[model samples]
Target: MQLTVFFDPKFLAIMSNRLQNKKSHKILFLDNTLDVGGQEKLLYDFLSRIDRGRFDAVICCLKRGGYLKDAFKKLGFGFYEELLSHKYDALAYRKVSRILAKEKVDLIHSFIHPNTVFFSHMAMLTRSVKAWVLAIHASGSPAGGRLIGRFQKLFLSRVSRYVALADAHKRYLVDVEGLPEKKIDVINNGVDVDKFHPGPSDPDFKKGLGISEGEQVVTTVASLNRRKRIDLLLQSASIVLEKRRHVRFLIVGGGPERNRLEHLTRYFGIEKNVTFTGIRDDTPAILRASDLFVLASMRGTETFPLVLLEAMASGLPVVSTDVGSVRELVVDGESAIVVPPENAEALAQAIEILLTNEEKARVFGMKGREVAVERFTLDQMSIRMERLYEHVLSRSRRAD
Candidate 1:
């Protein structure tokens, strides 16, 4: 009798030696943009930390490029922006296929949904392109939006590998879409622990934001989207201010919901207490300035929020609703506080508890920082990803 086991301390290293002995495999990382979103940030961190000697990597953006392209250029990584218009853009598809073949890209790793279809075809279309891996960032549940949405749901079955950011997302693909469970893998998005670690509260940072001395600042850094529930935070601000007037609500990040949510703040008459700072790049500094962090997202699909780790790293206790992987990341009254979704009153109360109790909040923040440093660091995530890539490649090699 025999048992199968897995251990590969030298997989990447062996691959690197193979590359030196022969030809190296190239990677084409396809995404919608190089923006400051979760998936984009994950890519950026990977672009920095992955074992560069093991494989050659180039980041290719589908449409409008963002700040990250410039960052990549500065780091001397290949950056290309080609607007695909839509997934089926024939001209864009041809261009991508040509690049993959001409560049000798071994695999195409897609970060968005449309790219899955585009690249999967490019693999067949190019005739020699090998592997295609798709990372499902959203919940991936079937929504009855339009004809296009229906087609997207239908297309999910044909992707090479369906990678979920959380177990919930994997379950959605398997249970909701009937995708094979064996084809799905859970890879939680990781954070840059060094840059986002628990820094000392910057007094100057608070002063720059016009926050007076000793006045606590509670903040939420997320897109001003309906899913993120920025309006709920505004309402919670109204409730929190009525009780604790010394605190300020700093709303970071921007989106289509900005003007409407700002109006909602005015409607609630808490505009004085709420500050809408648009899509801030200085998020780590802002988190350092904050006393507590709140993620009031109404969406159950948010598997792992990078902001929660950022908050923890900045030494700020978190007050987020019990949704998605929030339960996985935070412990009630221990590492962080969790409330029910859409309950602004409860949300505000949780924020108030963290605010009113300074010592407990600091302890929670410290514990959260510990968890982040130990478990969720960028290095750990990069190594995990390197292994995943190797696993997919090894399977592909075996199949061939």
Candidate 2:
């Protein structure tokens, strides 16, 4: 009788290791939180579309939970939570070190403030991770003023690589933080062009919001915060209504400034012309239903506003304040009208220029759409990230 022999368990383990060595690189993303902000959304978009055949993705947060936690879970990623209790908690260092060792993570990419400092330090101390990439999405001055800026500058040199969301932000790091310009990589924020393409306004959405068919819709999708300067949007809306009574203003977000903004709407006596659709999930649809998109931010908090790209993808012309990297995104008289920040009269005039000139508005919208599809698609961003990962991994292997 012939006896068949199965492979030994030790042999099988060795074979498995060999196969895994030929497999995709494992990447871990560490963020301060999973909240529904620009940075969090960008992380989601990048992770969701990254080529799984080339990179295995995992996510962890310094804080335990956030609004986007469920959304991230739904994307079928491995997730860890709450590595720290307080800012200086030593237990976090141990936890991070243990996680890196256990997962056999090849690379770690961290975003935003303290998370960047913490993860970069851990990667250096443990030497467990092969490469560390830090992503900074906003200008440091408005992120938390000069104090937080100092901390970032001090810790940034410890990481293996750096990413900035805009050229303006890259300049900020070099000019204000004293970092070498060559070390930073500028990756502009991108959107899903296929999902946010130009479409007919949803008739049901318009009706539900009490917007009539013939009225011009001017909309802004931003958190109603003082820095956002939404009050200026309302003041401008009032000015637009006096000249064009057929126009309607749609404000699409919720924040602490909601009550004050509502009061301003009443104070201007144009309550019927404005409707605040608080915290909508259907932002793409809202953009389709609008004639113009406006953002009157009063601070340097925005590096590259993702909403501007979304508005362009939806075929809506933009009118925004000259803040952060907005001018880099929008040409002065082509894709958008850029006005000085905090000037209600200038903001109103810009809005009226687009409101009255349909041909100019159409041309601007079309050009914006073209620019977004060419430079800011999700696929383009993912491809750039893949290149970055490969480059860093190649360098690490050479060093070893």
Candidate 3:
């Protein structure tokens, strides 16, 4: 993450008391939580590679900071947790504003829904911050319903700029949510290719997961949530197993929908062929030990999933529901077999097609790895993001 914190010279001159005479402009990265999720991991990766000479970076979790707290701490970035206790926490907002003022933060880059809403309101309340950027990682309502969605949009209308992970999502924000089209930047998700690449399948790892030798592995790494549609994947897995018995399905990650998904696997009478690994830190290793990757997310939910980038980086042929910016990520027939969401037959057919044809699957995997390297590397994403931050900062200067 290149901090590239820019502020208006006039504001700096007028607010001399609050503004500091420092070489590096401070930035505050806000999020709802520090849970082991894609957003948090993305932030971690950005911070790990941040250009410290250009700007100072800090993170504040509005709610709870779970799992990744120590990881962030080890990276030497300042981390704050439990800044907001409830929805209507006026004092907490004031505290956050004070922190912004004291830090002399030049920018506030917030992620996802509730945190974006909170920071949007905070941007209105504080003068210390120059730019407010909110990245929309998913589509649909803002979680509570039309009422909350309206409130969120109303608050975010005043933000400095918006980061949409895909052009499809950028259109949705302008068309459905009535946000300014020019304010949205479509920056695709990226992965660390060095960490995830073509490698030999680990026989020991497969055996530990109850996968027998010579059994092909089809894996999906996602939170076991309804929007992720892990149940639909299980249904397709059942169909695939009826014809292809020498295959193992690994449903990675844990969420509220775990028990129901497990029950569904049993209901399909394919319990022996499926394994739920809950959550694991060794995702790169797991990806290397798999034959294929699949994502059955529901329509209008996911947007430029980082897991897909990871899978592509790992040189695995993909089978994904045509949702969000999947088309932008992988060529339909070259790198992956795109299928409609909630269609088990299509998913099963695509899975079977890839598994049956080793040469085709290998070619797809090779193409996916090529795309990952050529288009979606961490350095490429960071450079683009740095430029956006600079643009937003420069625009803020002109506006002031």
Candidate 4:
């Protein structure tokens, strides 16, 4: 009899050295802009909770840094705005190369496809960057209607690793985007449980939003984009209002689709029953004030929405269309009600079920809160990201 164990010496050496080394690596996160959206906010929340002692983070926006730049700076992280006059700007490329050389960035992590392409070009200009990671926050590629969308397949080679928000999202990357399965890491998006928890709804907050007493509130927090299907929600609201007039639908967040969605709301003749709150900083408060949360998004537009986690964390029963990786977060019937996407009748029926049955909705909310706290918390996500950084840096070192 013989017992033999085979292990790569390089892996053992890397593991042994990682235990003794605590050197911090500087990471440059590149994005098209720091707009007030879920992806931007996710990056902010992760950065705020990331292990400051283990890693350093810098944000470089190819265009403007948008509103979140100042918020990022308040966290003591470096932020830069490198404007690109066009898609292919030689001067901007040179400027970004200087930034890479001066900052001595150890790794480059980019969000969206355009920024990934920008990172690929900069990698060729500077030898200081050792590794780069691409995070596909959305479900499909060629998002945001950019010219670079046509050429992303040619530029993905420079990415050291790819991050998918959920298992289904990972499959899409591997099957549709042709990314290698081994190189893709599934890191589920997490929410701050402490910040968004079950709490008493403020009367003034409800009153300010025109929510009357004894009225059941059904809220949906999503960017008012066409893919979000705000129109579908409004159409569903019309049906729900026909039955439950006491139910008020609160449409939170804003985007380019506001005007068109508002027109659709008017078209559905549910303007009085629905209130578009636009983009607000007080999402936690809004979620707390709601009796039920609804998300009516079309397929391929969402990839594990952060708003769903916020709703669950706030202890609100969710009635969402089955899209993206939503099923990964909530059980179809236990934690929340899942319905078919793009179906107003089914969406309306799901909302009515939760709204009409008070006890069921309460139980659903409790279970959802449990799920959010136990599985998806800021601490859990931050620790996983820290380990990922270590793994990428170690591999980059071994390759050298």
lDDT of each: 0.76, 0.83, 0.84, 0.83
**Which window of ten consecutive residues has the lowest lDDT sum in model 2?**
140-149
lDDT per residue for candidate 4 within 1-400, as digits (tens), equals 9999997664455455578885568898888888888899999999986765567788888888887878888988778885688776646766677777788789888875564476655684356688878888876632532222556666776677888999998888777766799999988889999899999988998999989998899999888778888889888899999988887889998899999988887888888888899889999999899999998988777889899999999999999888889999998899899999889999999999999899999999999999999999878887887788889889888988
Steric overlap count per candidate: 1, 0, 0, 0
Question: How does model 2 fare in lDDT?
Answer: 0.83
Off by over 4 Å in 3: 1-22, 141-148, 398-400
Residue range 208-273, candidate 1, lDDT tens digits: 776777678989988777889888888888888887878888988888999999899889887777
Q: TM-scores for all candidates?
A: 0.89, 0.91, 0.90, 0.90
Q: In TM-score terms, which candidate is top?
A: 2
Candidate 4, pairs of clashing residues: none
Assess the local accuracy of residue 88 in candidate 4 as a C-alpha lDDT between 0 and 100: 65
The alpha-carbon deviation from the true structure for residue 264 of candidate 4, after best TM-score superposition, in angstroms, is: 2.7
Model 2 bad stretches (over 4 Å): 1-21, 142-148
Instruction: Give the per-residue lDDT of model 3 (tens digit) for 307-380.
Output: 99999999999999998789999999999999998899999999999999999999999999999999999888
Better of 2 and 4 by TM-score: 2
Off by over 4 Å in 4: 1-22, 141-150
Weakest ten-residue segment in model 3 by summed lDDT: 141-150
